[model samples]
Target: MAVSFLNRERTIATPGYSRWLIPPAALCVHLCIGQAYAFSVFNLPMTKLIGISRSAPGDWKLTELGWIFSLAIFFLGVSAAVFGRWVEEGGPRRAMFTAALCWAGGFLVSAVGVYLHNLWIIYLGYGVLGGVGLGIGYISPVSTLIRWFPDRPGMATGMAIMGFGGGAFIASPLSVWLMGRFATPNHVGVAETFIVMGLVYLCFMMVGAAIVRVPPPGWAPAGYSTPVQPKPLVTTQNVFVYDALKTPQFWLIWWILCLNVTAGIGVLGQASAMSQEMFRGRITAVAASGLVGLFSLFNMLGRFLWSSTSDHIGRKNTYFVFFALGTFLYALVPYSGAIGSIGLFVLCYAIIFSMYGGGFATVPAYLRDMFGTRYVGAIHGLLLTAWSMAGIFGPVLVNYIREYNVTHGVAAAQAYNVTMFVMAGLLVIGFICNVFVGSVHERFHMRAVEAEDEVEAAPVFGGR
Candidate 1:
């Protein structure tokens, strides 16, 4: 087994390292440890503290928290792209080390800000510092895993990336429990929570980074040197980022990602608040909280379950489901109740939620297929800018449009209808794009890939 993954003759001379188990190890930390999204539970307590200190609800707003998240996302891409180049230059081990430092350090710094009652400091810590960590850590395993299991790109990357999304499910609950222990009405013990979470994640994420390593060159998976399925007209050869970006397929994917992220993030940011707004007259606070928890459960499951489904269905078809089913679901959200059922609304959102989650897990494999795996981490980094853009558009659209309706005499129930309709429109456009996606044409195939394969095929200077 070991011999299959190593250079027995030491001829080609790319270092031999373990690749098979590392991706899941990286994802274990990504999924189990990255509960940062659940950072919202800390928000109300922080808000209350700021409120007690004389900040207005609107001024010390939860929306401000959105900025922190948005900034983090903005930098996540920037960091990944900048650092991905580094990963290419050095290796996953080096990249993961950098990621670990920034991750923990960001938290430690943010804890100081919280203790000092300085929001700006907290922003700097979590947004700038932590986001850089996220970017590095996120892409660390992608190219490595793709290299190791060339046969199963979708399943490999999906398993780890899916964990990043699902990490919050467990973290959110644990965080809430932690906050409860540390919180006071005037001060939610956020400072301590930051310190503790930062410490814990630092340790966990670093372990992941520490464990990862690259595979030997020219080696394929045990049973998969020549793919059982026909290699797409595409291969990773001579492919470069600039060339891949030039293709129509790239832009189509970009738009699809932008739409997918925009719809889901808009809903995610406002899930708890939306629940409260919807049930203001009819449901209690406890019930609303329960609904939010249910939403979180579904959101986390969608990452694991939906992306795993893609392993069997293939990336193109998986996205076809996302864009098509998601559009229908978005359109249904507004009228589900008036059409006589809350159950429909719940079901609609749930499916939309899964599509949003699946869209993320599917992309790495899709990119590896169209472009070569050589620069996959970098290409993926570049692609995440779409998510950053959506991070801004999704929430702002929901907020601004909903506010306009309320100011112009729309009832609270009707406030989000316009927004829902807009989301539905966007999903339709994405569906069309997904429908058009196919394997890249041969003209676009990279030159380096061909040369590399040709070199490997030639008779060795001495064999057997």
Candidate 2:
């Protein structure tokens, strides 16, 4: 009986329900799960768990700790692909609730792992369990928001996803303060911090699950009309989630997203180190840290601003701008360093980060354009495999290329020049993929009878 409240039938928005409330509900989940971006803050503290003041003999290496975030990201894509159809069928409330449990539980279990000094336990708890939570929470609100704001799907998705990019701002400082508050002579306070954060996140996420509601069937914003003549690339037909895999357009967009992300994510992870290395005496550790913060701000803002712009300029054109402008900016980075222009170097990366974020925000609307709204959430889930792959590919490319250059006696400042060109080359390939993202073939779309039967088999409550 208690579980029934989470059913899809119970979550349908009643007449006169305010759609404006939905974005905030999404923000609750996103802002919490987005803490994954700041998990690095814990890496150093976690290494000191045994020694308190410094590394002990048994302490986990930095390289081993790095796998925690990698594992989380990898599982995020895997779980999203595996469970996406269930999320679509189950409703946002159920998915959000389950994600909340897993997310908070991961923290609690990891706290125990820290207390026990078991790295593998931390990997299973935070990496696998928390990652599943991140995946579910991430997509739970996407299709709901799209349905509620069909007139401005890009902007709607951007509003929710922007929280993910912004979450680090809140989490980074909060984590630092929490550790400080809990610290003592023998304890670094990591376990205590995790406990507090977990409880806080659980409470916040529950609020989102409670408040979220899906639109009733056939509902549309007042006076908004479906276009009689759909724009180029915009489809009126729906593609089954699995069938979408068979479309050439799907793979093209997949490559487009993957390559774009690889370029930015590699650089993003290495931003501080790269800035300090490239500029040498001119860039301090403090200044480099500030640059990372700046990247976060721009990354967050671009998600909203560029995605909203896509509503006007179109998704394909938006990605075109990302690849075209992004490629030029990446190539410009080495020149910025060569001239020793800190301002230009920062500016180049700032713009690049914005488009990197823009790429994430714009793709959902793009999927809606080619595949239609039904199953877009599930399709989007499948598409996130690109992100998982890019996560591994990007960091490895930057780290390995830079190491190889330095080992070969390249100057620190000049070492990243080749890597920058390689990133630019990646963008060139992404641009070509974007160029070929035509509409899906008619045969892949669900027929009217099939769509009707499916809808009848799973009717939303208010439609009756």
Candidate 3:
């Protein structure tokens, strides 16, 4: 009730009754914005629209549409790194407000682009401008939420980032429904779709932003939490972020994440298409699209389930499971056709996709456990640039390697096998990085006695 623009570092109090409200508020925004993945639903329609508008309708290709979505993801990471510092300083509420504004505005901008038939404008609006909002909105509440629920950093982060994974779930159906309502064959319904979706997400994310606040200083979860089971810090309060940067731990985790994500994302970006290509008769294009949607279901569940499991087992153990288990499953995709069972293929793909989602949701807590939460948002933002990198490498590797195999006279079945092996090797390397995460030791971490935010942390959590 005391929420305002005042510097939030000062002491404030809320009844214990209010503590339970924060996590649900966090989930609301995530559930909506996570639809970024579902942008695929628009691919055919957008291409249809473009083909109709262009004099040479037959020349338009699906790859061109893929590029538009890929561009959006590439900028998502780029913008996150640029805005991370601001999000840290401004507090979650302020950061989410900016995200809502840019994201909604990007939709309106893209709507205009579509209405005017300017593909470049649409790209600029969604890819460059909206992507920045995606990045900022993604990381804004991470540090504050982790601090609030130290007992469940993995679960807390999973809950927040899970939005990114599940965004497509609600998006796919909604887009389909709206498409039916507004779509015409010669022209796409995208303008209206963008207008309606943008307005809806703007309202939804604003509600989330309004409800968002960091836990009061020195606060702890209602019951037991992460602090009680002691782990040594890697660096001291005296240590600077630059100093933490120098340690091998930082870069090691970086490569591990890069490899892990690349292996998974490569397959994920291609799954529906891959399914359609691999099993022509057993699954229709609609069935293949359903397979892709199934991936989201698994991806969303893994974020919550595996991350919560980390609360009990520790983060390293979770990554151990992901890399080791992921390595085996990823290696199976191309060769799994020996039996020729489509259901088997779907189940296998679902398992791997879940790990992909789990890896993302779990990594933040892994960082916090070793590094301390003082500058977690900035550090996590920097680390997520790995995703941007994955956004490039995953698709490129699969596309390039498969192209080579096709040119070499390798059959369609064998074309993807070698790439699958390469992905497995990458997972092996990630497994090693995680295994080598020696304790951070207190001397290596950045620390802070209090930000203005500290005025609130201790008093709120000090007692029951």
Clash count for each candidate, listed in order shown: 5, 0, 27
Per-residue CA lDDT of model 2 for 18-126, tens digit only, reads: 9999999999999999899999999999889888899999998899999899989998998888878788778899999999999999899999999999999999999
Tell me the tens digit of each residue's lDDT in model 1 across 155-256: 777778777877787778777878778876666677787788888877777676556656655777566666555554345454556567788888888898
| Candidate maximizing TM-score | 2
Q: What is the C-alpha lDDT of each candidate?
A: 0.72, 0.92, 0.75
Rank order (by lDDT, best first): 2, 3, 1
Please, what are the lDDT tens digits per residue for candidate 3 over residues 1-464? Answer: 44454234431336463655566667666766677787777777776665655434543367766766777777778777776656665677777778888888878898898788777887888877788778877887787777777777888888877777878778889999997788766666888999999999999988887676666555676675444446643222322334557767777778878888898899887787677767767778898777777787898889888898998888889999999988888777776765676777788888888888898888888777666676677677877889989889998998899899989998776677888889999999999998788766555643344433433342332210
Instruction: Give the local distance difference test score of model 2.
Output: 0.92
Order of candidates by TM-score, top first?
2, 3, 1
Off by over 4 Å in 1: 1-20, 48-65, 182-187, 228-238, 276-283, 441-444, 449-464
Best by lDDT: 2
Model 2 misplaced stretches (Cα beyond 4 Å): 459-464
- Model 3, residue 118: displacement in angstroms? 1.2
